[model samples]
Target: MRAFFWAAWLGLCSTPLLAAPPQGFSFAQKDWELACDNTGACRAAGYGVRRGEVSVLLTRNAGSEQHLTATVTFAQIEHDIPADSTASLLIDDRDFGALDALDESHFRLDSDQTTALLQALTNQRKIEFTLNGQHLPLSSAGSREVLGKMDAFQRRTGTADALLDKGDAGDDAILPATPAPEIIAAPVLHNAQPVPLSMLQRQKLLPILTPLLNQRCDDWQNQAIPAADRQITLTALDKTHSLAQALCWRAPYNDGYALWLVDNAQLSKPRLLTTEASSYADGAIVFLHKERGMADCITGETRVWDGKTFTPSLKYSTGMCREITPGGTWMLPTFVSQVIPRQQKEADNLALRTLYNAVLKAQKSDPELSLNKVAEQFPLTGHITDFTLTYADDTLITTSKPSPDISDDEWQAFLRSSISADSENGKVSFTLIDLDGDGKRDLIIDSYVGGTGLFSYTGVLKRGDDDFAAVNGSDSDNGDDFDAGVPGALFSINGRGANQWNHWVKINGQVYALWYNGQFGEDNLYLLRPFSTTSQTPAVTVRYRYTLNSIRSPEKDQPLTPSLSDGDKADLLRSLEVMQGSLLKDRPASDNDAPICPIPPGTSADEADNYYSGVAVNYIYETVAYIPVWLNGKCYIGTIFSHHGAYRHGVDAEITLSSPREDEEVIGDYLISGLRHVIAITSGWKTREGDNGMQ
Candidate 1:
C-alpha cells in the first residue's frame, strides 16, 4: 500500500501547482512520518516499541469536507479478546476508560476523546493501553511535534483541524464537563399508508409512486408501454379504511406509473409522500438511499402529520443498514429445532428476530463453548485479542506474547498456574479486568470441558485480600445456567473452548452489561442498563440501540451539563471569536449581524443553547464543510451552527471543525438554504483539541 501510494504521489507531482496547490508533501516529525496527499489528506503515523508496525495514527481529512480521526493500534495478540471488553488508558497514571475499539488492534477515539488524547500524547511522559492482560506502552517522544505538524498540514489543506495548547498550559479535558445530550433522532416508522388518487395526482407524488413503480416491475430497462397508456392508480390507506381509484394515465421522468399516496392534510402544499422515498402514514416517513461502497446506507425520518403541522416522530435509522427485509427469498441457517433446518429468509423483521432469538437461546444452552474455539473458526472477527493477566494496580503480570525461552511443556505449566490452581479438565483462559470499579484488578476465567454443550465453567474471579475468589453469582461455580457468551450461535457450535462474554460498561454512575448484536465491522451496540437489586432475578432496560453515528440524536439528546446564563453565553462567544481569527479571511460583513447560535428549522440558537448549555455545550465538535456562496465573486469565513436538512433535518449527521473562529472574527451562522451560493467548503466552529483554550 505504501508503494502504491508513493507511486501515485510521484506521478501527480509532474503537474504544476498553479490551479491547485502541490499534490503531496512529506516530512518527518519526531519518530513519525507526517505525510499529506494532494487533497489535504494528512496522517501522522508512527510506531511504538516495534518498528514497521503501526501503533499510533492521527488523520485529518482536509478535503472538500473536513473530518479528523485519531487511532491507537495495539500490537499482535495470540488469544481472543471480546471487542466490548473494557481497556483502560493510563496517561501519566490517570485512568481514562477503555478507548473505543475500531478493531482489536486499532481503537478510534471520539472527537472529544481524541482532543483529550492529543493533549496527553503531546504533554504526558507516559501512555499505556491496558487490554485483557497486556500492558502496551506508547512512547510520547516527539508526539507533541507530530501533532504540531499535523496541525500545520491541516492548515495548509484549509482544515486548521486542532489548536493544541502549548505544553500543559490549558485546562485539563481529562474530565471535560459531562458531554451534552446527543441529538436523538425521532422514532422511525416504516409502515406505508394508502392515500387517495386525487391527492397523489394533484401533488405529483413520487416518493410513494416510485416504490409502487418499483414493486410493479424490476427496473425501467424494458417497460413495454409509453407514458399516456400506462394505468396510474391511487390508494386511500388508513388504519380504518383502504381504497384505490384510477388516476389519469401519465408518468413523469419518462417512466411507467403505479398506485401512489400523499398526505393531503400534512403540509402547506400537499407534500409528496412518495417524492422523497418516504413512507406515508400519519405524516410521511422520508428516507434516502446513500451509497457507501457497494452497500446501500439508509437514513430516514418518521414524521406525523398533525391537523396543522408535520411533526417529527424523533425515531430514525442511521448508518450502513442492510435491507434485513430481504429483497428476494432464500434459505438461511435455522436453530429453531435440534435438527438444523433451512428456513426461507423472508423480507420481514419476524424472520430476522426469530433467527436472533434462536442464536441467543443456543448460546445459553451451549455449555462447552470456548472463546478459543470461536477464535479458531472466525479469525479476526471481534474486538478480539490475546489473554492478559495484570497485577492489582493494572500492572502486567503475564500476556499472550510468545516468549523465546519457554518450551511447550513450560508454557503449558505457566498457563495452568497463572491464576487458577488446577485446570479441572477444561482449557484455562483468564483476563485481568475490573468489574466492580475498585483500583484492584479482577479475574475473568473460562474453564472449559469437552463437548459442544454447557461443559464450560466461566465467571469473574473478584480480587480478594490474598488471591482471587469466585464471584457471588449463580454461574460462578460449575453450573448449567450462565450466559454462554455473546454470538450464542457460535457458542453453541464451539462449546468446548472458551466463553467470550465482554467486560462491563459504566454509564453515569452505574455499571451495566454491554454487547454487540452484529458481527465485527458492522456494529450495533446493545447497552443493557441493569437496575441494582439484591435478588438474583435481574431487571434490565433490555437494550439501548445505536450505531456510532446515531449515539447523539434529538430524542436521545440530554443536557449532560449545566445550563449557561445568557451572560455566560455572550462572554464565551466573545472569547471564541478570538480563536476564529486564524481561519477567517478578509471579507465584508453583511448588514445583518450573525445570530449568536441559530438553530434552524424552527429552533433558535438560544433554545439549543439552553438545551446544550454549560462547558459541555460550548465544546461540541460540530464542524461542517460549507461553501461560502460569495456575493460578487468573493468568499467570507464564518461558523455553521446546525444544519437541518438531510433525512428530516440534521438527523444523524456530524458537522465538526478544528478552528471555527479566530482573530476576533466569528464565522457567520448563516443557514445556507440553497447550494448555488456555496463556493468554497471548509470548517466551522466547535473546533477540535481544545475549545477556544477552554479545553
Candidate 2:
C-alpha cells in the first residue's frame, strides 16, 4: 500500500546597493600610478617611445554607459614610427581605435575616461603583464595598491573578477553547491494472519467492533462491493497482528473472508469484521441462491462440508470463472470468449518438436558448428548454464541446467550482437533471421567462441559441383603444376549459374580481391592476393583544391545546389579519384592479413562505414561548420582524423570551426554550456558528477 501528500509558501527584500551591476568599463593601470572609482572600475597607463613615445591606457565603466573612452600622450621625441602607427585597445577580443594623438608626446581617448576606461579592462587579483612572451613586473607601489584593491573587492563580494571589474558589479554570484540526498528502500510489512467470517453474522456485530479496528489500524479505504455480497477483503492488518508475523499472504485481492461459526442467537446484532483479519479477493465475491425458497449459496472458493451424515457426498467443491458483468457472477462460454484454444497446447508442442529436429540436423551435418567447437575456438569453460528462447509471438520458453561446452568469448560476443544473453552464467543464445531475404526463413547460429569472444555463422550449404575448376584440365597458368607450385591456392566451379566460378590464391599478407565472372579466363575465380601490395587500390582521395574551394567560396556557390561549370565540377570529381597504385611488386605474403571484403558493385559504402565507424563524421562536420558562425566571425574550416576506440571505432578526418567571443545565439545552438570551458570560453559552470562531485 502507498500514500501521498503536498505543501506551499512566499517573500521580499530592501537593499538599493544590492542591485545588479552596471555595464561598461570599470577598471585600469599605468607605468607607476593607477586611479579607479568605488564602482569597481580601473585601467593600465603606459608610455612607449620606440614608436613615437605613444601613451596607452586601459579602462572599464559599469553603469548604463554605451561608449568607452581612451586617452593617450606622446613624448616629444622624433622616432622612426610610421605615420599609420595608430594606437588601439582590445575589449573582450574586440579591437577599438584609440583617440587621435594630441602631440608627439600625448593623445586622448574619445570615450569617458572614468567608466569607459575601467570597463574595457579585466581585473586580476594580481595583474602580471607580459612583453614578447615574457613576464613583466608590476613592482611600483601604485600598481600594487590597485591590485590589492581588486583582490579586496573579489573577496568581499564573492563575485567573479571579470564581472566586477567590467562595471557589471552587482550581478549575483553562482549559488553555493549542495549535496544531494540519498535514496533508501521503503519499509516492508511482516507476519500476518487471515480470519474467516460470514455475511449475516458480520452485519449484526459491526457497531461494537468498528471503533476498535479504526483506532488500531491506519485509515482503510473500503473496497467496492455490492450490499448483497457475503465476503469482504481487508488490505492491512492492525499493530497487534503485524507484530505477530514476519510475512503473511492475504487473499490475492482484497475480499474479506468468512467466519466458521457465529453465536447470533445470543445477541441482538452480529460482531463486526476484526481489524486483524485478511481478505482474498477484496470485495469481489458475493453469494446467490439457487431457487427463490432455497438458502444462500457460497460464492467464494473454500473447502466445506455438506450437511450430510458421514457420506462420500458430504463434500462441496468450487471452481473460479470470470464474471460476465458487475453483480452478475454467471460462468458460461459467452462471458469468457477471449481464452486459449483447446488445440493451442498441441500445436505449440508440434512447433517445438520441429525446431528441435532442425537443431539436431544442423549439429549432425556441421562438424565446426557445435558448442564444443565454440569452446575449442574460444577460452570459456564452466558449468552448464540455463538457456531460454523467446518466440516472436511473445512467448518465453526457458530451460535450466543445459550441458555446457560453449566458450565464454563466443557467449559474450553472442550477447553483444543479440539482445538476450545470461550475464551471470555466461550463456549464449541464437536468433534466427532471413539473411538471404527469401520468403523462407534461415537460421543464424551464435555462440561463445571463448571466454572473451563471440562467433557467429550464417547457415549456408555449398554444393560440391559448384566448385570452380580450371580450364584445359590444368590448374597452372604456365606449364607449372598448380598444386606443386601454388600451395595456398584453391579453385572452384560455380554451378549455380553459367560463367560463374572463383579462384582463391594467397600471394601476400593481404587478401586482395574476390574477382568473379569469366572476365579473366574460362575459369571465373576470385583473386585472393594475400601479401601482394599491387592487389590493393585506393578508393578515394583528399584534393587540396577541394579543401581550398570549400572554404573560399560563398554559400551560394556550393555544389549541392544548381550544379557548376565543367572545370569546377571536374575538380570536385577529381578530388575523390584514386591517383596511384601500390609501389611494392616483390614483397612476400604474410599469414592471415586481409582487406575487408567489399560489397558488390552498385551498392554504397555509407551504411557500412557508419556501422564500422563509431564516431559520426557528419555530426562532427556540422558542429565544426557552425562554430565560427556562432562566434560572429568569418567561416573557417579544418579537419582532424583520430582513432576513437577498438573495433568499429576508427574516425576519419572532417572539418572543424573556431572563433572568439561570447555570441550567445550561435554558441547556444552548437556547443553544450558546460563544455565551453574546454573550447576557450572563460566563464562556464563545472559539470557535477554523483551528487555534488564536480566532473
Top TM-score hit: 1
Question: Native-vs-model 2 lDDT?
Answer: 0.25
Across 142-204, the per-residue lDDT of candidate 2 in tens digits comes to 443454453443332333433233333543442211211111111222233333334653554
For each candidate, how many residue pairs have backbone atoms clashing (under 3 Å)?
58, 105
lDDT for 485 (candidate 1): 33
Worst 10 residues of 2 by lDDT: 1-10
For model 1, where is the 10-residue window of minimal lDDT?
Answer: 332-341
TM-score of 2: 0.15
Which RMSD values do the candidates have, in order? 26.2, 36.1
Candidate 2 displacement at residue 603 in angstroms: 44
lDDT of 1 at 521: 12
